[model samples]
Target chain A: MKLEKIRPSEITPEHVYLSRRRVLRIGALALGTAALSACGLPSPSPEPTQTNPRVPKDLPTDKRDEFGDPANRWEEITNYNNFYEFTMDKQEVARLAQNFKTSPWTVTVGGLVNRPRTYDLDDLRKFGEEERIYRLRCVEGWSMVIPWLGFPLHKLLREVEPLSKARYVRFESLFDPDQMPGQRLSFYPWPYAEGLRLDEAMHDLTLLVTGLYGHPLPPQNGAPVRLAVPWKYGFKSIKSIVRIDLVEEQPATLWNTVAPHEYGFYSNVNPNKPHPRWSQATERRIGEPGRRRTLMFNGYERQVAALYAGMDLMKNY
Target chain B: MRVWLRAHGLQALVHIGALIPLGVMIADYAQDRLTVNPIQELTLRTGKVALVLLVLSLACTPLNTLFGFRGALRVRRALGLYGFLYVVLHLLVFTVLDYVGDLALIVQTVLEKYYIVAGLAAFVLLVPLAVTSTRGWQRRLGQRWRALHRLVYLAVPLAVLHFALLVKSLVGRPEPLLWGALVLGLLALRIPAVRRAVARWRDRVRHTTSEWRVANRKWRMANSK
Candidate 1:
């Protein structure tokens, strides 16, 4: 044969393939679909994460806020991180956490639950999964939008079946002093711990994230698994979790224990409440010029505000 | 070479050395290598440089006081000016880049954050020192100038405290503590009692060495006779 004619469908359009805006629009549409269906409507199959030539688009494009504000550069997202378990230097975390072993990890769910069970990584992955794009705000006055792959926390909680005595859900990170260098030094009360109220843990927006950017969670970003409560400050979403205990009384968290005056138990993203060391009114969004006005509950007020209806946010914060 | 270096060349070297950090920052910015959190990187780097140079400037007094080095006294003004420059750059990064020209937010931040308050106080304390560093102003103020410059003693510890407070926590950080110790040690050396004690020790050592030389000479002479 002299020559073969190229088929039109074989070649993807350059604009559709290369434009991040289009991908973000698609992500927003996906999120919109999820939100709509969540109200007793039939859930639609989520769009498969788009593979960009440069950046991976694995997380849902949140339909709310400015969806197309250029998902922070992938390098910025991965390189500039804050995982204190490895080291305090933001640049050094990725390098230090790279060698951390996370396989064969098990998380024990105990305390005031009807079914107390220790789950392997595989067991956690078996729960229903989705791509959720949410904004993460740090108490340090910086923010980032992340695409996380995980399931609703409620799914796992349902399986465990919390008893009537379960008022708060406690999460603890791996505390091996030999492995986690930060644990060796008592800068913080060792064995980083955090908690959420029963309702907050069971909220639809709460996620038990397992992966990010279509890859297994980076060691620095929290290895085997972690929690992602987008409505609260980043630290509230504990990383490299090893235990989940439901308690009748509010649990003592690491930050609260270290500096109770600064970090409250709730630690909800409230722009009105200023951190003792810094202002929370505005936050620098990574890869974006200047600071943006931080939103209430980090812009998830519509979905989460009702949860804290009468509670004084300032006092809780 | 020593003589030439002691004259004006050493001060020139100090000037060149002091500017290198700023040059590196500019080059990093131009080359697009300021890292992911460039604003933060710049802020922290400049703040560190300012604190280091401030401590170094303070060190000049102790160097001169203990060693009687005239050159140390000469470079004191230059180090202080450079430290002030870096402090300005640090504040510029925080206000312009971090706060982004929001005057209301800036005031709110300064009011609410104690670290910001401490840093601002340190910078304000340095302003008069930098302005009066000129030879003309120094001559005009005369004895008052020395009194005014003593404010650096207060400024340095506050700056270190500001640095300590701004970090995640001070439990593990030894850098700020080391700076604080150096400042305190230098200040302690300024006391008249400590200075007199050091001088007495030096005179005793000198006297003992001369006496030993004389005794050895007498013993040799007696043996020759």
Candidate 2:
């Protein structure tokens, strides 16, 4: 209750003595460093850049590396989400997902696959650690550069190869109203689902991301499983996946079902094709000062451009 | 005011629990768990709770009449104060922190948006009621007290209409419309003409539903025996 009652007179002489001692200690450290330099021991080097400059995702320079490299503060993860069933309130999912059942997660691989197998999260993790740095573009026109640690969908697909008939891979999230309260909201069609072209699914860049920034994904950030398509808008990367089905026909996505004009099945993050309501080219980097411009195919044109070679992105979007 | 304080001392403590959501929400914003403008979420959330308490306050009287519970009005005074407190906070937050002295935008909201206008109207109506709620004022005003308090009937529906119009066009939204319809239905039940019509309709329904009750009673007696 007395929060604003700070009195300068309360500071004793001993406190001033301690403050002086700290400055003296810092001065001694400076002298010691200079002396060490004179003795031929190397001076400490400045911190290296946070991101791996070689990686394509690191090309964007106007960003704040508040999380440091490979260990992002969990803030960005909780805030940036597309759990549409949770009333389109991005933070609501993360706040509301504490009650979600992440354990006992088993991905059922079925449909046109030769071997339809149910793999627990442990089974998937057994394949081991592989980190891929990627840029995630939200359909709402924001972006983040994240280093996601996970295995490729192709790696999993090879274990249970899709038949020649397979043209698309459909992923479904878990659906238990008791566990996921978003299901209670009558607005969203729960058991959120997303689809990917077989070619896109097979692409080296496409991943079934289990971790971000070298840490296991938090429950809110889609614990057991989530899709990570580096080239597409983040909405296409559905979270809390339970089933993956390979189909002959191109599959529909939840957003396209709700608003065909607003969201497209091929919601690839092409900066040139603006979303109807907002500009897609310019994006607010999550932890940065300036709004950085987005890139074509989220700056992965070389890797993913060929997949949509002849198609007009604007029309498709 | 003194009577209210004495009567609601315990109730005040219980209703203060409503402030927890605001604190938790602000904490989330500070923690960056929510990307929304913090002030915006807080304002909307407080306003929403205020509207809920207001609606719930009104529902008590009618609900008592329908359910034969006479003591329900005991809670209305405290609940009404909670609504008044939250509404004041909601309005203050909007005019002060949210606008940050942008007089033009504030004026624009007061003028352009019918919902904000209605909300402002409701708050303006509540001020005199809240001030005159004291026993002293009641005694002073005498017969005029009833006239002053009757404004609540108008304020409640206007507030709901504000919410309904405010939320109508939001993407994938229907909650406000449902609540609006519910308030409209409740208000309709209070009008003498509409009340009589509904009584006829409801009496028929009670008769129909009561038939199942007699059958269930007989089934229960047979099963027990």
Candidate 3:
């Protein structure tokens, strides 16, 4: 079914729209009067300044995945998170992670690589950045459209130069219990880890995200650095990286290790493959009132489907 | 005031306590504090309250059976009905608010999701119990009324299982298991042997208490003389 293009005005709730419009009008009137008196010239258009100012206009962003759906508000994207390292409660993660320290963080890259090195946050940023508006579909049957700012994972892989035998890229999050209280839970295997096939890691759509909505990543949203694999379920995009390893065999992931049947190793978002406990056929879009049909490979089928050409996703899942 | 409290206070407390969660949910909705997914928040909150009330209702019989707390029987019906009310609300939110009353989708979910099926079965079983909870129906059904209400023993466990299966990480979370344990303990108290033993213990305790009371009264009368 086709979803009618939702205009920006329709996206904002009525009360929020009215309040923001009033504030904008008052600000414009003041600016207009000042500009007229100062130089007898008309005030510059307020359109650019009034809209989302966090995301710079010049940043290159792909709009293909949006399909006319507007990006979720910054608050919705940041506040509603599934970083289990912080907490299981999605809304409480933001508040609990308010004091989390992300500075002085280093990600160690090794295992089946020629130029093994540990890069700090600054060193990682030197590879360059671009903005991509991607749909993040969680296995919990919820989704969000986020404008993420980061370079492709291929760039980092090229710099590291993986060995010929390296078959998988394993990612690990920080294991500090003092900072991340959720890590103290003995039930969960701490130091959250995830893995992707070497070729999948080299895909251009796979991002090593550092920011979102044109702002640096918040603590709850995987500050310092995180991975964003648009096609896979959100949990596959491991957060708060502290280690990276290239292995010959598939590495064990936290979710897969905990519950292999429910969360498969290749957690590509396939609506046909329903979760053991729930359906993946539809997802509730964050900030929206109703559910929407989930797309195959989260609507990145064109870019990533070729990667899984011969293999059956159901078995892999 | 003390006499009036003894007569009516426990019932009043039960009524108020059962409705507090609903009040909190409404307050949260009005204040926009239901988090990002308000429908999900409503669904989880209502479901949780329903389960809690149902468990509390189940505990009432054991309370009366073991300790001879006759007051426990007075609020049992109210607790069960309140639980039924929340279950209705929970299903309403799931149907109207969450699914927009999409019959096909709701039916599909009910068939496909085991948790939904379990919850639906629990709700189905509670309907007859809630309907016949009145004294008039109790009189009409006679001995059959007792047998009908025993369906609660089955319904409570199904509800607990529904909760346990609904969570994404049931292995890591012990809440559903804890609730299961509580239900099992309450069920165990219903066994005839256990009930008889508890009754005998209660009788012995009552006999000793009355003896002590008479002796204390006699001592007080002597001191006054």
Model 2: per-residue Cα lDDT at residue B109: 46
Best by DockQ: 1
Encode model 3's per-residue lDDT on A160-237: one tens digit a residue.
Answer: 999999999999999999989899889998889999999999999999998765556667889879999999999999
Candidate 3 — what's its lDDT? 0.84
Q: Each prediction's Cα lDDT score?
A: 0.80, 0.69, 0.84
Worst 10 residues of 2 chain A by lDDT: A50-59
lDDT for B71 in candidate 1 is 85
- What TM-score does the first chain of candidate 2 have? 0.75
lDDT of 1 by residue, B75-114 (tens): 8889889999999999999989888889998998899889
Q: Put down candidate 3 lDDT per residue, B1-225, tens digits, no spaces.
A: 999889888899999999999999999989998988898899899999999999999999889877778898899999999999999999999899988888898887788899999999999999999999999999999999999999999999999999999887766677999999999989988999978887888889999999999999999999999
TM-score of chain B of each: 0.88, 0.74, 0.88
Candidate 2: C-alpha RMSD after superposition:
15.6
Candidate 2: pairs in clash: none
Off by over 4 Å in 1: A1-67, B1-3, B201-225
Ranked by DockQ from best down, the candidates are 1, 3, 2
Model 3: docking quality category = medium
Comparing 1 and 2 by TM-score, which wins? 1
lDDT of 1 by residue, A140-190 (tens): 888887877688999999999999989999999999877778777776787
